[model samples]
Target: MGRKVCQQDHGQSRQNSNGHSNDHLFSTHVQAVIVQLSRPVLRPGFRPDARLWRGGIEGNFEVTISMYDASVGLFVPYLRNLSALLDKGVAYAEARKFNPAVLLGMRMAPDMYDLAQQIGEACRHATVAAALLADREPVALPVLEHDMAGLQARIATSIEFIESLPRAEINAAAERNVFFRLKNGTELPFTGRTLLLTFSVPQFFFHVTTAYDLLRHAGVELVKKDYLGRR
Candidate 1:
């Protein structure tokens, strides 16, 4: 008798003339095959459901990489720019024989956080976001970076912590549950991806941008590129 072919939805399986399963046969013949027949089958961690993305699957690990990109590539660099701007501001203050601390308290409005607090909060958001998503231990708590040097140090510490985190550890956190506390002591729950996009990223940008605005308002020689860290 001739060989027979059998197929299943979204995949194919074959049987030989002797009725043996083709799994080993096909594996030997083909170096690689992607059987998207089920959910949670991909490597680099669990597979995503094809149904979740209109027949496309984005594994949790990949999403974590995206978060890392945004957090590190964008967030940390902006903070570096802020630090450079602060250096310029300090020089200007000293040249005029003025107290640099006056600029630390400067804010767009009296009700909002001052520049020092904004820098601290910005660093807090960056480091905390990395920790929360990676399920890693926090390196530092939020502090009042009330001076340019202090704020710069805080930002540098955040960068170091973020850089030290392993990519696999962050991606593995997909299965872990994360939580954040709000101003009124309310703890909001989150999944790794959810926490990164919905909360951490937004909070990070808000504080960073506020710090930039405070500097701009105080007449620091800053351009859009300075705030964006493109230069």
Candidate 2:
């Protein structure tokens, strides 16, 4: 017997080809979620919502621009952690009758930067990242922070520096070319988007995580929650 019948969707499986492809609908929905959460594209003036794109796309330049802010945003927590942990670490060392300087100077590897340098580098990256993203001149890296108080001040200063920029200036940088010198003393230019996603953001996190690792390796009682400051 030859037959054709409309089947109602009960939400059991994603595939429904009777009238429309539920499989396609579900697949597109998942892809959109991934883009919004992780892999956002940088397209100036391109709206992210479904109403505008009409293809279930889920992000825009604004979302990508927000990454710069979020890059700085993540540093906020890093700074706070460093502040609290530095105090706690000092106390821990005092309790054990060990000089805190030894712990502060320790690194997971001999070839790597020490805790003070790690914290300084993290702050420096944040400062430079915000300036480049906003298309402004970077503030000169402050004199290297030595003590815990100096480190905390450096972090706070970086945050203040980033927050001082106008959002419009940062957003306007989507099309701007940002020139930066490589370690080899040669300059490499990048569009603001590439600079953030490829260079600044990664460098910021690398130092942050390294700072965290330095603290944890030195036996500071910092859990993962300490790494990611909560709301």
**Top lDDT prediction, candidate number:** 1
Give me the runs in candidate 1 sitting further than 4 Å from their true place. 1-65
Candidate 1, 1-231: lDDT as tens digits: 233322133244444333443343333333222334444654887665435442232222121134455555556677778687778779878988888889899988879999888878877777877887777776775566476677777878887887777654564555568887766899999887787778888888898788778777887777777777765
lDDT against the true structure, each candidate: 0.68, 0.66
- Using TM-score as the measure, the top candidate is 1
**lDDT of model number 1:** 0.68
Q: What's the TM-score of every candidate structure? A: 0.68, 0.67
The sequence of per-residue lDDT tens digits that candidate 2 reaches over residues 1-231 is 224333433244443212333234334665666556453458876545534452323222112224434555555666676667677777878888987777668887899888888877777777776787776777666677467766777777777787776655665565688876754788778887787788877887787788778777877778777667665
Off by over 4 Å in 2: 1-68
